[model samples]
Target: MNSLSRMLEVLNLFKPEQPVIDIEVICSQLGYTSASAYRYVKELSNAGLLVRLPRGYALGPRIIELDRHMTQFDPLLAASRDIVGDLIAQTHLELLISELYDSTVINILQRSGADEQALNFGRGRPMDLFRSATAKVILAYLLPRQLKRLFDNAAPGDLERIGLTWKDFSKAMLRIRKDGYCISEGELDPGKSGIAAPIFDEKGRILGSITLAGNSERFNAFNREFLSTLMIDAARKITSRIAG
Candidate 1:
């Protein structure tokens, strides 16, 4: 691998569970020579991307600062904050807020009303549509050109099985645009259900969405049409807040 790629490879050796790890483990995982790994690690540490923690090299606060800077001016988050909070209050369930970037779901913020111990994500988490209802709603709203670009960048035949070709996909999107909500069962995760509605500005531009989410049993008992109405109402309230 190239130098930059190899440095990134070493960075991945640290996870939440093993936030600090040794050079030996890093070399084994990245298949780099011990000296090369050490050199890269030392460089990264000096640059503040990695830190020499008690255990080994853990990510430093600089990365956190980078993450904060990335999210500080994200318009979608600025626009949709209130709507998500309202959804949490009314449904007493969790909300997963995400936006599309480069056709992949990039930014995520979690909202919860209940204990939330059952929720498995957090603010600033990145998500995938293949694993979320939030992804489906965002995808259902993109223009045809954007959708084509997304497909071209995705696995050659991966999205075809999900049936989002231009013809049918446009129609599906129009439905959400008209009714302002999407109800899908077990789309985000096994046994999870979601009710999401698009949040639109006064100019009728779609910002993102507000989703009411819960695990299988609680979600299954929810009335889709009822949840749809709630989400649509929540979106309207949130849009007004954003506009103000």
Candidate 2:
């Protein structure tokens, strides 16, 4: 990999569970020698992308600054904040505004209701493409070529767990497209169910998804048609607002 790509790989290692990593840990995890790990970490630290923590290394202040900038200027987030706020108020469910960037589904905006359980994801957190309702809606909208690439690169048996084969998975996606929404029950987080609908850009490209999440019991208590209609309407409104 190029130096830039290697640097990003290093940054990607710093996740929620392993937020602080030292040179030794990086070397072992990435199968790099001490020299290579130190070189990569040094370059990142020099660029202000990695900070030297007392224990190890953590994402530096630069990341936080960039996140702030993105949150302030992102068009979709700006357009949907108030609308999502309204959804949370109306349904009393946790609402997530997520987007498909390349093939990675990211939770970009979220609002939680008083009684709803908070999800593990947050702004910039990568949502599981195969698991979360928000991710599945976006996945269902991928171009054929994109879908093929994703399927080819995915870990084995992922398609099977979702449906059993490519044909089954395709049919499931078709159903989602026809209905304009998707619902998942305890698929990602146990006991948490979610309903999601896709948003499209002016060019009709899939932009992302808007999701309402709640405890499965609470979610089951609501009328399916009513909740799906509300989710679809919210997704459409966000799409239109951003497209405009």
Candidate 3:
């Protein structure tokens, strides 16, 4: 990797579980020489992206500042904020807005509801490409070449979760696109279900998805058809806001 790429890779090494990483671990994990690792650490620390800690290095205050800027200024988040709030108020279900970042899907915003079941997805967490309603909805709108690339790179069991073959997977995505929404049960989180619809940009290119999730039993008891319609309408409103 180039120097810039290697530096960014260092930041990606930090996670919720491994929040602090020492230079030794960075050197081992990234296959960098001790001197190179120290140089990278010094550069990152100077930029305020990493803070030295007794244990190691933790994400710095600049990350939080950047997050604040995104919350205030990201177009998708700004467009969906009020609409998502209204949907949560009306359906009393957990609402999530997820965005497609290259081949990965990540939840950008979420509002919890009455059901206390912990979700596997949250802000900044990656979603399963085949299992999540949020991810599936966005996948449905991906270009054919893009879809094929993901299909080719899919993990061993990933495609099997959705279909036995690529043709089957393509047909499944076609159905979701035709229907304008996707409903998934126990796919990401056991005992929870979600319905999602894709949001689009001014040119009608897919941007992301809005999902409403709740207990499986509650979803079964509720009017799924009506819920799907509501979700689609909300998605359209957000798309319009983006266009405007």
| Top model number, TM-score | 3
**TM-score of structure candidate 2:** 0.87
Error of 1 at 20 (Å): 7.2
Model 2 deviation from native, Cα RMSD in Å = 2.4
Question: 22-42, model 1: which lDDT tens digit per residue?
Answer: 888887777788998899988
Q: Could you give candidate 3's per-residue lDDT for residues 168-243 as a string of tens digits?
A: 9899999999999999988888899999999999999989999999899877787878998999999999999999
lDDT of 2 by residue, 1-244 (tens): 8767766788878776898999888877777788888898888888889999899999888888888988898888887888887888887888888888777888888788755458777666886688778888999999988877787777765675556567777888888899999998887778888999999988889999989998888888889999999989888887888779
TM-scores for every candidate against the unseen true structure: 0.65, 0.87, 0.92
Predicted model with the maximum lDDT? 3
Query: How does residue 213 of candidate 3 score in lDDT?
Result: 92
Per-prediction tally of clashes: 0, 0, 0
- Models, CA RMSD each: 5.1, 2.4, 1.7
Give candidate 2 regions above 4 Å deviation. Answer: 31-39, 122-124, 155-157
What is the alpha-carbon lDDT for the whole of candidate 1? 0.68
Ranking by lDDT: 3, 2, 1
Between prediction 2 and prediction 3, which has the larger TM-score? 3
Give the distance in Å from residue 233's predicted Cα in candidate 1 to where it truly belongs.
2.9
* lDDT of the candidates, in the order given: 0.68, 0.84, 0.88
